[model samples]
Target chain A: MKRVEGLTHSYRFSWFALILAALGSGVLLLIVAPLAALVLSTSFGELSQAAADAQVIQSIRLTLSAALTATLISTVAGIPLSYVLARKEFFGKTALLAIIDLPIIIPHSAAGIALLTVIGRRSLLGSVTGGLMGSAAGIAVAMAFVSVPFLINAARAGFLAVPERLEKVGRSLGASPWRVFFTVSLPMAWRDIVSGMILMWARGISEFGAVIIIAYHPMTTPVMVFQRFNDYGLAYARSVAVLLIIICVAIFVVVRFLARPTQEAQDA
Target chain B: MLELRSLSKQLGLFTIADLNLRLNHGEYFVLLGPSGVGKTVLIEMVAGFITPDAGRILCEGQDITNSPPEARDFAVVYQDYALFPHLAVAANIAYGLRARGVQSKQAAARVRALAEKLNIAALLNRRVGGLSGGEQQRVALARALAPRPRLLLLDEPLAAVDIGLRARLRHELRCIHQQTGTTFLHVTHDPDDALYLADRVGVMLEGSIRQVATPQELFRAPSDAAVAEFLGMRNIMTVDSASEGVCQVGRVEIHAALADESTSYVWIKPEEILLSRQPFDSSARNQFRCVVAGWENSGPLLAVRISSGDLTLTALVTYESFSELGIDAGTELYCTFKSSAVHCF
Candidate 1:
């Protein structure tokens, strides 16, 4: 009787696993199938030609530079705010968190419009700083406005994972608050902050509606792809899209490799 | 030496009010209490991690109440050790020295000396993540002692270790206190930790220090019922009335050498009560013919609960005597103790 029961149990386990695999493959294929088709459809000659094109190269450079700028600025400003959110409780804390998440929730074009009212020509900040419209700075601002929440939230989670007792021990050891932050808190949370920066940079690189509405002349890669698809058709645009995806993936892989925690950090 | 004068803090739902304590230099003082008595808050206040709402903390006659934790020359070894997970054991030991602007070469020497003394020399190069609980504790001790602070605050440093390791660590803590000559203020809820480690123990209750004395004194004479109860004397009985040195408890009368007219409760350590099958001709002033109500094996001793009329008493006896007396539920026995063993408050 026990043998028969065990057999039936094994049979049920296999059946459940098979169902899970089948359902999982549907979502996996939905993502991989299109990406595979896009890469395969573009010939090597077309990919090389698109990569060598001066306009395509310039747009990619602009996209990389603007996204890098946005990511750097966000990392510098967001880490302190993230640590505060992780370690403190105060009035309006929930509301402040909602505000931080607003960029991710709002439509991209609306985010762009919101950016314009502050930094566009004839606005208060714009008049003080001269116009930012049609400039790379405007593209960076728009990308940052939409993507910064990723970095803040991720870093906040990183800081949250660190036990407050560790920081207290650091301080009691005669290390100042700032020293404790740099040596204890930052190193422990380093992996999460790095991952958050990568996510923010990737999100900024893929921004289109915000960048287009804010700066059209200094065309980013996504904006150029959209314009090329509208003006020259899918074949021409597919080559550029393929090149961008390849470059982004390669850089992502390299950064991920470089960002892995050291032996000591892994122990942490 | 350290002193806290009228230290008070209002934490959520709990308040540590008008707490005052004094610590002599080069002594191992333990703040012993049950859990959730705000012991951690008081320790943190002394360590300068949590600021007291009202009071002054004096170190060598200098007020340091408003100083940041870094400015206070005190180190803490938390219950979980809180070793820096991102650093090697050597690095963790050298951290406080590095913060104090000590050169790497000098700091490395101090770290090695500490590791050698703590018997963690083999673990210097290893990361803290995979260390045994006892090893982590030694590393934490080394790190805290690196800068040689005036006082060391240990918040239940042995609470996480296994029972055997805890005993060994307790011995090591005493050795370190004597070797370093650093005033140690260790806090714990476990009375065993207090009994095994402390040169002097303070009984904390309701967020205040109720009594402070040597461990023997705290055991022999607790200031109040709360102190006696916390000290593992479970035989506290309410007195109906007290006159001179005798008190009435239920139908049985207890003669206490320490009882006075104002006494409302009488207490005796379970081990002080003797259990026997026959009455003995001895110096015991209090005696009762009790029926064994229940008994439990408590390690090497047997804890027997007995009833005499309407009053119950817990008496601890050696297993040898337990079997000799044939104590079990409904077994008639005589329990006796000297009048001096019964404390009244």
Candidate 2:
């Protein structure tokens, strides 16, 4: 009986199904071919040489740490703002939402310039921040400026998913508003907020245009790649690019392994 | 004791205007209304979540209308239960205690004790998302009752529980209310929920309290036509004339014991009307000759709809009586009722 059913199903679908699967594979190859070729083109000896270089290692460390710092700062400051945007309605709420989304749409170089005007020693905020131009702090500031929208928007969507009734129950149970936020809203939004943090961090580390414009002297990994390509050639930059991609892929795989929704049934 | 005096708010076209009510300490009061009649809004107001546009809420004879919900010493169980999805059953139950600075060991002990009482001890470590509707409701009750709150508010608590478990949960709620001795103000749209649990019920419609009485009183003697219509009363008519203890309604004179010159309407319930093949002697003063307009089986009994002149009256009869009298639609019958059963308003 099963064999008969299978024959009837595949007779109707076999060729069409094969062609559909081939189309999907073609798209996958379109994305995978360049990265595979980039890695394959670099001889192992060359990869080792790039790996051994002290400057390359230091730049990698600097990039990862700065990205993490930027992500941390965004989370601490953005979660509350995200919650407010999710729950409250007042004057100019739509305008505020649009403004929060502006960083993601504006050109990275323009974003770098905007950051500079506010933190370039000549401006009031620049003096307050001790003139962060061409410094690691400036690099982090540029990266955060370009990437914070991802964190805020993701966290806001997470907060919006938590029902208002849950929060009201918390308050009715003799919990203060602050307690309700900490215990009820924040924990419920944890998964989305954490994923957003990871995305923001990944986006921050890849920031070449904005960081190079704002703080080139610090020589983050992306800036170093550009410099190596200019001084030497394609062979030099390709290896570093491959190394950065490997590190990003490794970290993201671990994060995804941790974040995949558990099979356990969730509460209503 | 709790009192709401002139509680008023405008929610975009629907208005809760001048709602005044009082509940004695330890009273189980129900605010009954249909869905979207602003029942939940009133519960929120009493819980101090929303500040009323005009009113004063008094608890223990002190005004607390402006107090925040946290300071009100009240607990609420929502229709959806709203158990924290991230927390385990024990943690959800212990949340109120922990928020109030209860010690870890003490809170854990109290959570366990409450879980035991609610028959959910085995589920203390289970995640809320994995529980069934009945289990979630039990957890919600345990959570709200853990802190021994001064006042408990229930918003259609049995809405999510299945029919099989509703009666059991309702009995448990009554037991819990007695054990805790806390004032309970439960709001529900279910007639059975109110009748089973409420010591006194306030019928609310269009954001106003129409009448406040016991379940029997509210069913037997509703104050107005609207209340009668809401409670499923059908034998209502305008009184053309009212004199000493008698009112002429739709060309039939109904002997209403409470009738006076001021009365303008009369309400008669279906269960109070008796059906028979012939008129017999009885203390019931009001009797009418009616035709069997319709008959419907309501489980063990039958609801017989009878029409007399222009007035329609519903009378209920047992299955035995229905068979003994050979009653059916289009049969002539005599409907008898007490004059006291005729409510005049």
**Interface RMSD, one decimal, each candidate:** 1.5, 1.8
For model 2 chain B, the run of ten residues with the poorest summed lDDT: B226-235
Error of 2 at B200 (Å): 0.8
Angstrom error at residue B122, model 2: 1.9
List, for all models, the DockQ compared with the true complex: 0.61, 0.54
- Residue A241 of model 1 has an lDDT of 95
| C-alpha TM-scores of all predictions | 0.89, 0.86
Candidate 1 chain B weakest lDDT stretch, 10 residues: B219-228
Residue ranges of candidate 2 with Cα displaced over 4 Å: A1-5, A11-26, A121-124, A127-130, A263-268, B242-247, B253-345
Deviation in Å, model 1, residue B47 alpha carbon: 1.1
TM-score attained by chain A of model 1: 0.94
Best by TM-score: 1
Candidate 1, B106-183: lDDT as tens digits: 999999999999999999999998999889989999999999998999998988888998888888888888899999
